[model samples]
Target: MVKIRLKKFGAAKRPCYRIVVQDSRKPRDGTTIEEIGTYQPVTQEGENQFTVNEERAKYWISVGAQPTETVKKLFSKKNLNKK
Candidate 1:
């Protein structure tokens, strides 16, 4: 199964994440099928915290890509929870 989830990155105390599409069997930071967006949880309020490619996200979800819990919330914020 394909999943839409966060890929961890950044320094020891600062974490950034990439919202990516990957196979369910793979490791968390393993090879991804596509990167549809990004998330920076530690960013300032005025700065953009996350971004999602609506078109691509819809396409992936349409094809049965399941978003993890956290990713689902992000989708809900953007009103992309169609499935």
Candidate 2:
């Protein structure tokens, strides 16, 4: 099974995340098939805080890649325009 989920990265106090597609059984921060976006919760709340390739994301989902709850919410919040 494959899933779309977050991979953590960044400094000790400043956390960032990559939205990735990977095998469901793999480790959370393990290698992924592809990276579809990024999330920076510490940054100002707006389109600049995240960058998602919505087209790629939809393609993965259609093929049965399930996204985590948090990633799902992020997708919904992002308008995917103006960038």
Candidate 3:
């Protein structure tokens, strides 16, 4: 199955994540099918904490891509799961 999930990145104490599309069998940081956006929780409040390509996200979802729990919450915040 294909899934939308976060791929960990960044330094030891400072972590960021790329929201990517990958096969469910792949490792967490393994090859990704597509990178749809990013999330940097450590970034300051005023900065852009995360971003998502709405078109691609919708396309993936339409094609039956499932988002992980965390990713689902993020999408909900942006109203991306209303479809």
TM-score of 1: 0.96
Arrange candidates by lDDT, highest first: which order?
1, 3, 2
- How do all models score by TM-score? 0.96, 0.86, 0.96
**Deviating ranges (above 4 Å) for candidate 1:** none
* Per-residue C-alpha lDDT of model 1 across residues 5-80, encoded as one tens digit per residue: 9999999878999999999999999999999999999987699998999999999999999999999999999999
User: Candidate 1 at residue 18, lDDT?
Assistant: 97
lDDT of 3 by residue, 17-39 (tens): 99999999999999999999999
Name the candidate, 1 or 2, with the larger lDDT value. 1
Q: What are the per-residue Cα lDDT tens digits for candidate 2 across 1-83?
A: 99889999999888999999999999999889999999888876554778889899888887888888888788778642222
List clashing residue pairs in candidate 2: none
Q: In model 3, which runs have C-alpha deviations exceeding 4 angstroms?
A: none
Query: Over all chains combined, what TM-score does candidate 3 have?
Result: 0.96
